[model samples]
Target chain A: MSELEQRGVPEETRTEIMEATFRAVSEHGYAGLRMRDIGEEMEKTRQIIHYHYDGKYDLLANFLEYIIEQYEGSVEVERDVPPCEELDIRIRQCLFGPGFEEFDHWERMKVYHELFTHAQNDERHREIFDEHHRRLRDSITQVVAEGIERGDFRDTDPERTAQLITDVIHAARERKLSLGHDDAPEEAVQAIDEFVVDSLIVDE
Target chain B: MSELEQRGVPEETRTEIMEATFRAVSEHGYAGLRMRDIGEEMEKTRQIIHYHYDGKYDLLANFLEYIIEQYEGSVEVERDVPPCEELDIRIRQCLFGPGFEEFDHWERMKVYHELFTHAQNDERHREIFDEHHRRLRDSITQVVAEGIERGDFRDTDPERTAQLITDVIHAARERKLSLGHDDAPEEAVQAIDEFVVDSLIVDE
Candidate 1:
């Protein structure tokens, strides 16, 4: 439905280039990212990368969108799945999932943090990051609302509860990435599980 | 007494330079920050900034340490005060205190986020960031343990409870900075207050 969806296979090359950019960024940082480094990562000419993107900024903007899409696609709260279970899966994914385990996951998160940090000063980039936040919040809100409706969760403020969960998960992720915390994910899972059980679950 | 404290009032110039760097990064962002822009912000010759620090990277690393020290010095949980009240004050500081309301607050947070994102690949920067995280966590943990000991709060695992509080607060700050959420601070205060009451308060 999106332009990205319509492009299909051609988008694969775009994604490949984005991944290469990600590697360069992970190794050298956003400030240090260079076309030559990206080209070296991709084993292609800078011209080829330039053909796909105007410059580093342009490539990074698209890369931001691409990773957002990839993340959104990875976590699905299915209709048949109990909302509580779905919430667990989502939280676990945020903390201990393969995404957290893999270097690529951490790398992508670092770049995402870079975009977020940059968004504070760049109006154009702010819009992209804002949309990403909206989508992420909406997805979590849906799960919270469904859990309440299914009678799995207590009758509480869905939006506030969802926001709380998001805040905790995000804090954990940020600390882990920036502080080189190996235990953050597990600690997050334990903390969230306890918080949810105490604050959100309906008493039998 | 750290090197910074040892410098005393003579450090006013150091703080001035750091503030100038903050303004430059706040406007142009970390990646775009240049010595010329920093000098222009301070209305000082580039030679002055260069004389104090070797390069942009050196200036930024020192700037990171400066801000971290600044933040650590902001909040204090007094021994004679009721632990619950101390906890309340600390949470409010994280959420809606004047510290969070000032433009300088947002600017500093943005710059701190920049360092965090950059620390992913830079080991030296990572050590600075790691120390910052540890100190923040320890501060929160002390408040939680005191609250529990004084029976101003429920008996709970203080470390885990502290981590939960940190996660939610951090997430709220991150989202506010990146997504342009004007309401995040207030929302965070509400969410965290309610979570504490429900999860940790002992019904008297």
Candidate 2:
């Protein structure tokens, strides 16, 4: 069990709070968000939220971990999926994000990036973001390594290639959500296909 | 003269205010920054800052344009430089950022990304960020097109390639500054060299 899970908030209640936090952040933004705002999104009273989490800062710190966990847990593929296909799915998932019942992909990403930007000034938040980056890069590296071992991809530096692909996916999302560049994400996928992915595949 | 220039603030004083804003934002962050904080960073009093700009929001809105202007003006290469060299210099400048006397590149980028995040909620700030993104991508596109015309680059889609390169540079900076992934920027440069730049160059 994760450290956060061990803190005694039940898994279902925690998921509810995370979803409410997402809604609140979507409406109010990171700087302006309040516990009351999150409470309003939830069916429960604000006292319930305060009972579980200490305050706005504490809740947000936990919210950061919660959202990252959601993303980490959301990515699932068939066991029989090939490495090349798996890599493509993972890249697309990062770029487009997974489907959520309450919010669209970009909506969740908007809140995610807001929290991400806040990490610059907050040490705890920065640590969380650093861990997420490391995990993401490492996961992509693993896939690339598997592809190479399977004779499906050209032999290249998997770590560097993963870093490159991860950065591009991140930048494309930032462009789409932050700058309102509607075409940026699709264009990024195409570029990755032509440049990064094509360069990875070996001749049949 | 630009609309901002025509608003009656002298060019030199505007630059000073912009620099002060950068320092204040760097110190206090976007959410915590105040007019007095900016005044403290400047030689002038708080009233001088108040006299020129309406409030913290207005000052920051202008500061967004000011830093973008600084970056736009800072990219200077000799007219005789070839397109490929110019492209390399521009990419490096974006990834590493141009040297500033007051603060280093990442310091400036930290503040820039802070304001960039604020743009998600503010319409005016969003417009400024949008304009900056458009200009950065277009400049890179122009360089790529020139390189192709000169036969220095292969026949690839210049617009798409430029967008890919620009996004990677942005992501690299964000990773380095926000996540404290110190190696991200240099690693991005390496990946671009092998994947993007080498792919651009025509075979001997």
Candidate 3:
């Protein structure tokens, strides 16, 4: 937070504005958000954000840098996923947990999807998406690789397996969004969990 | 083919328009398409198409209905899998082969992706996407259920398995898009196909 502010605004102000920015961007999408709205929410002048970060582009860049930095810093891979007999269950939970059943998850996906659409035409947005995946795959691969070595998983190709698990979660989210409206059918999370778990675990 | 043109222009004319529509819509997306371009390509007046049907709206509707009909009518169930030693390899190819190589797959994906994006606002587009899944899933599920009965597959829940496989492909397409431009990376296709195959098959 200090680093982000030093790069632009004061630490507290930047962090507070960023919280409002994420909340606004996540809910209303990039198109619907306005600097005045964020200022009003945070009880700060729009000029403050502008003076600190240059403009919207700088704000977007700093916001992503801050978020990705925090994402990387907080994900203590070795500590987060402790291993045991319920290894498969833990892996499944980590990937497709009901924890992601939060409303924030859905809105977050919508925001990301909107950016993905724009990324087709904008190089900067595409870079963000690419960086997100590269970091995610690397981090997950480390845990899955370690799990296999510690006898928690089958001696399968960890890189391949990590990508597979990643794709499964990605697919499930798409399914939720596609069928997410009023008339769309609900899918059982446990069934999908089994499908993911059984697909990856050792036959023993 | 015969069924679609029973009410339209000469069968050849209708077929020509539909094929061009698919190529155009699939390549440039539905919103990117123009009725006049389709008319010019067919070398026919809008009046001709209007006389045959209603207009561009009718033409696109008939085209979608036609694809749906063709999908249901002529789906190959792959009965020849025939208890082989290399069952997983064959099954993998069956799920994601032929139409999904580096060729028009991007274009195909583009149209569906466009529909997915617009479906956020358009109920009609969402219905078309859901129906596409329903018919495709029904055909695939029937094949899977029969395989389970025959002791080929592990007697897993057929509908769920169908959903998972479709979801995998859907996600892989998205991941690949996020990673590369135009054609999916060769590595992505191989990785996706191998992961999907590995998950679906029983060891011989």
DockQ for every prediction shown: 0.71, 0.83, 0.30
- Assess candidate 1 and give its TM-score to the true structure: 0.89
Tens-digit lDDT track of model 1 for A1-204: 755455452766876787787788777777667888888887656677777676778777777778777787877556788787888888777655445333557667767777777777668788987877777777778888987888888887878887888777777777788778878878887887777645777877
Best by TM-score: 2
Off by over 4 Å in 2: none
Q: Is 1 or 3 the stronger prediction by TM-score?
A: 1
2 or 3: which has the higher TM-score?
2
Per-residue error at B125 for model 3, in Å? 1.3
Question: What tens digits encode model 2's per-residue C-alpha lDDT throughout B1-204?
Answer: 666797899887888888888888888888877788888888866687788888888888888888888898898877868888888888888877788897988888998898887787789999988888889989999988999998999999999998898889988888887888888888988998888988889987
Residues B46-68 of candidate 1 have per-residue lDDT tens digits of 68777767788877888888878
Candidate 1 residues lying further than 4 Å off, grouped into runs, are A5-9, A43-46, A77-79, A98-103, B7-9, B43-51, B76-79, B97-103
Those runs of model 3 whose alpha carbons end farther than 4 Å from true positions after fitting are A1-81, A84-103, A181-196, A199-204, B1-103, B181-204
Fnat, model 2, is 0.86
lDDT of 2 at A5: 82
Report how closely model 3 matches the true complex, as a DockQ value: 0.30
Highest-lDDT candidate: 2
